[model samples]
Target chain A: MQDPQSQIVVIIIAITIVLLFIGILFLVMIWSYNNKKLQMAREKQQIQDAFEKQLLQSRLEIQEATLNAVSQEIHDNVGQLLSYAKVQLNIMEQQATWGQEELHAIKDTIGTAFTALRNIARSLNILKHAAATRVQIDMLYLPEQLQINIHDNGKGFNVATALTNKEGLGLQNILNRARLMGGAATIISQPEEGTSIKINVPYA
Target chain B: MHIHLYQYTQFLSLLVAILCYEGLCKYKLSAFLPMLVIVNLIEVTGANYRALGYIPWLSNHAIYNLNLLLETPFRLYLMGQMLRMRSNERLTFRGIAFLCMLVILLNYLFLQGPFVFNTFSLILIQILTIVLSCFILLRLALREDIRPNLWQDPYFWVNAGLLLFALITLVILGLQQYMQDHKVMLGGKSLYKAIMPLPNFILYLGYSYAFILCRIPKARSLLSS
Candidate 1:
C-alpha cells in the first residue's frame, strides 16, 4: 500500500510513458508513409524515362534507315545520271555548231546542277551517320538559346580518351560543328554510368 | 476575472478562422468558423463564471460538461468529412456517435448528475476522439492516393492536433480522477488546472496552422495562374 503522494507519482510516470509511446508511433507512421510515397514517385519517373528512351531509339533507327536509303539512291542513280548528263553536254560542246557563249552557258548550268546534287547527297549521309550514333536527343527552345541534350545508355567510354583518340572522329565532328555554330558542347560519361551530351547555341 | 494563456490561443485560432473564411469555404470547411466561435465563447464564459455572477445552478463544471456533448459530434462530423467517409462508413460512425451521446447523457443525468463534473463522459469523449483521430491518421497514411506533401495538408494537421489533445487530456483527466478519489492534492492545485492549458494551447496552435494551410493551396493556384 503506497502513500497517496507515491501513488500519484506512479500514475504520472505511467501516463508520461504512454504518451511518449503514442507520439513516437505517430511520427514513425507519418515518416514511413512519406518515404513510401517518395520511393513510388522515383520509380514512376524511372519508368517514364525508360519509355521515352525506347521511343527515341526506335524513331532514330527508322529515320537513319530511311535517310541511308535516300543517300544511297542519290549517290547510285542521281549522281550517275548527272555525270552522264555532264558528259553528254561536254560532247555536245566539243561538236557544237552553235555560238560558243551559248554552249559554255549550257555547260556551266549543268556543272552547277551536278554540284548541288552532290551537296544534298553528302548532307543526307552526315545525318544518317549522326542518327546511328545518338540514342536520345531532347531539344529545348529558350528565349536566347536553343539547348540540345543527348543521352545514351551505352557502355560509355572514357570521354578524355575518346576526345584525344584518332578513332573518335564522330566525337570531334560534334565539337567542331558546335564551335562553327557559335555554341558549346559538353560531354559527360563514365565507364558504366552511360553518357550525356549537352549543346547550347545562341538562337538568332 | 482572469483569462489563461490557453484561452488566448483559442481566441487566436478563432481570428485565423475568420480571416481564412473564404479559403475555408473553398475547401468546404466553413463550419469550423462557427465551431471555433462556440469553443472560444465557452472557454471565456467558463473562465469568468464567478466574476460574471452567473446563476448558482449554471456552474462552470456544467457548462464544460455541456460543451463536451456539443464538441464530440461536431468533431466526429468534421473528421468524417475530412476522411471522405463513404455512405456506409458515415452511417456506422453516426450510429457510434449517437450511442456515445446517449451513454454520456445517461451518465450525466443518473450517475454523476449535472452539478458535479462529468468525468465519466469526459473520459468517454476523450477515448472516442482519440480512437477516431488515430483511425483518420492511419487511413491518411495508408491510402493509395495520399497527398505527396501531406505535411501541408489541413486535415492532417487537424487530426494531429485532435490526437495530441485527446491523448494528453485523457491521461491528465484520469490522473485528476485518481487524485480526487484518493483525497490527494498536488501542491495545493488541481492536476487538471495545472496541466489542462498545455494541451489546449497546442490544440489551438495546430488549429491556427490548419486554418492558414487551408489558404495555401488557393494562393498557390492563384499564383500559378
Candidate 2:
C-alpha cells in the first residue's frame, strides 16, 4: 500500500509542475514583446533610407539645371551677336572702292570663321537643351502637387542613347536632383520623336 | 466535494475553454486563436473523462469515451499547430499526419484494452510521448525567430512545465507497473485519489494563462495598463 508520506510527495511534485507551467507562460509573453520591438526597428530603418535617397537626388538635379541654363545663354545670345557683327563687315566691303582683293579674301575668310562659330554655338545650344530636359511629377496626390517639370526641345536622340551619356553628367544630374526632391525622372524618345521627360516628385 | 472535484475541475476548465473561444471569435479569430482554444478544450475534457473516471457515465459508454474517440484528430491538431509554426521544409506535414495515424492506432488498442499490456506497449508509447514533448519544447524555444513564442523570451519555463508533468506521469505509470509485477495492492486508494488531480490542475493553470494572453487583448492591455 502507498504510504501517507508517499502521497505527500506526489502532491508536492504536482504542485511543482503547476508552478512550472506558469513560468512557461511568462516566457512566451516575453518573446512576443521582443518580436514587436524588432519589427519597429526595421520600419524605422526603411523610412530613413528612403528620405536620404530623396535628398541626394534633389541636389544633383539642381546642379544639372544650372549648368544647362548657362550653356544656353552662351550659345544663343552671344553667338547671335557675333553673327550680326560679321554681316556688318560684309556690307562695308561692298561699299569700299579699294577692291583690295586680298583684303576681300581675308574678309570672306573672316566671314567663314564667323559662320563656323555660329554652327558651334548652335550645337552647344542643342547640348544645353538636352541637359535642360527636366520634369517634375506629383506623387503625393497633394494639393498643388508640389511638382516641378523640366522640359527640353533638343535634337531628338534614341531614348537609350540619351540615357547613356559618356562625356557629361547630361541627364544624370537632372535625374539625381529629381530623386532628391523625392521623385524620379524618365525620358521617352525615339529616332524622330522628341524626348519627353517625366519627373515624379513626392513632397520634394 | 472530494468526489466531485474531478468533475468540477473538468467542467471548470471546459467552461473556461468555451469562454476563451467565444472571446477569440469576438476578437475576430486569427489562425492561431481558435486552434489554441480547441487544444485546451480537448486536452481538458478528454483528460477529465479518460484519466479521472474509468466508469462509464450515464448509460452512455460511447459518449463517455467520445473525447478519446475524437482524440486522434485532437492530438493531431495540437501537433499541427506546432509543425505548421515550425516552417519545417520536411517532416512537418508528414509528422502531423503520422502522429494522427499513430493516435488512431493506439487509441484503437487502448479503448479495446481488456486490450492487453502486451509487450509494454503503453510504456513504450508513454516514453516516446515524453521525448516528443521535450523535443517540442526545445523546438518552440530554439526557433523563436519563426515561431511565436507565447511565453515570451523566457521560453524555458514553459518547457519546464511540460517536463514536470511528464515526469509525474512517468512515476505514476511506473508505480502501477511495479505493483502489478509484484502482485501487490497499490497502497491506499483514497490517498492516490486525493492527489491524482494535483498534476492535472497544474497543467490547467499553465494552459489557462498561456491561452488567456493570446485570446484576451484586454487582459494583456490590463497587464500593461
lDDT of 1 by residue, A61-169 (tens): 7767977877787777666666766776777768875677766766666676677676675554224333334478799998899999988766676989988988666
Interface root mean square deviation of every model, in Å? 2.5, 5.7
Give lDDT per model, in order.
0.76, 0.50
My TM-score estimates for the predictions, one after another, are: 0.70, 0.44
Q: Which ten residues in a row have the lowest lDDT in candidate 2 chain A?
A: A131-140
Q: Against the true structure, what is every candidate's RMSD? A: 12.4, 9.9
- Judged by whole-model lDDT over C-alpha atoms, candidate 2 comes out at 0.50
lDDT of residue B74 for candidate 2: 43
Best by TM-score, which number? 1
